[model samples]
Target: MSSNAHSFYYGGKFLSKVTDLVRSEIEPIIAARGDEFVDIEYVKEKSQNYLRIYVDKDQPGGIDIDEIAALSEEVSEKLDSLEPDPLPDPYVLELSSPGVERPIKNAKDWEKANGEYIHVGLYQKIDGKKMFEGTLKSYNDEEIELEIKIKTRRKTLTIPRKLIANARFAIEF
Candidate 1:
């Protein structure tokens, strides 16, 4: 079979094993490449398993397909060689750039993103609302200062950083 066909067939059955492989090795590779490993998950659907990897750097365009492909190839080789089960069925391998909408995954990520606009949602209503989009001005030990603009008005709202249920860099277009 062609290399493409073989790879396509093999990319459907390794998740936990591959995750373990990447969670241990791929982070270092990403770090060395000046990027951060945001997340790794096994996407299982019926008879196929998809390995999903998310990596980010301080700004947009920090990650690319080459990085993902290199990581995927390395991880695949490592798993193919080290697995106790060796050839445990097949699986699909995917490496992707975690675009602008990627979630802020760690403190370092947040710190690097300071001064950028972000979209954040709260678990419960705060000051009668549960969502806020603003410039991430500053962050202290407890809360984050957001420069929010509502219509023709502007205000700096202090929100506990921990209270952010989810946050992501907003697209500036």
Candidate 2:
């Protein structure tokens, strides 16, 4: 088999295993620190692999750099002792807060996003629109209400929850 095909099947599976193991190792440490574990990804870019971890405080305000540094130290110590190491040597490990364009992954994200500008992706077109960027006024089990701009004018659009594929905090401009 060609290298591309071999990688297409095995590389991703191996990468997932690495990411999962890393998450299992670090998530408890993060939770014990009273923070939310947003996400973890292990990927290769330009011949180097990156183990990026996104975390946030459960309370109001962004997580501080000092806290992130301490957590990173703790996480490094834990991963260092893993019997079967999953990470590749020379991989870049990053621990930080999810910044301006963070994905909305849980209930707290939704609540924090209320009245904030965001990008919404849909599974199919809703009135010829498969996506929207607007102020998220509110959301519930059934749908979300967004105030969007139509040229100079603005209107509130009700989008069904079932149609949403992804939602994320976004910057306007």
Candidate 3:
């Protein structure tokens, strides 16, 4: 499953430095436009380097391509003007929305996901199940409540926050 959680290779000091530098340089510009910065990442794939920036609107309906294009240009210009380029290798910069099945990484993500359908993966089995798909009822620091279907009946499952290995929005067919 796709997730916003960075892989182990991306958690090193070098990647952390690049992420910090990019966030510090671009956050103010993004905030000035009244948009929320979801995340930023630097990764190497197929021998090529990539820098991706995820953004979303504070309101509903999400961001559009035009908005992404405008922000991309501004951020590109900002990076280009940095006195000493932080990245040692050339990388492609990408700006876009976190898609429908976006990973629930923080409080804001959980807040936005309330009442939405989601898939939760546990580090250990809960009720003999390691994974669950349900309508997110509520979430707080201690736990998350979901309304799940089982044999034609709906049940509420209270999952401890510590047990969740991953949680993300799920599209229902």
Q: Estimate each model's TM-score.
A: 0.72, 0.81, 0.84
The parts of candidate 1 lying over 4 Å away from their true place are 1-21, 32-34, 45-48, 57-60, 82-91
Q: Is candidate 1 or candidate 2 better by TM-score?
A: 2
Sort all candidates by TM-score, best to worst. Answer: 3, 2, 1
55-75 per-residue lDDT for model 2 (tens digits): 998667779999999999999
Q: After superposition, how far is residue 10 of candidate 1 from its true place, in Å?
A: 23
* C-alpha positional error of residue 62 in candidate 3 after TM-score superposition, expressed in Å: 1.5
lDDT of 3 by residue, 1-173 (tens): 22123322222334335677778889999999988898887877798878899998877788888999999999999989876677657989989898888889899889988999999999999999999999999999999999999988999999999999989899966
Off by over 4 Å in 2: 1-17, 88-90
Q: What is the lDDT of residue 132 in candidate 1?
A: 90
Compared to the true structure, candidate 2 yields what TM-score? 0.81
Clashes of each: 8, 0, 0
Give me the candidate number with maximum TM-score: 3
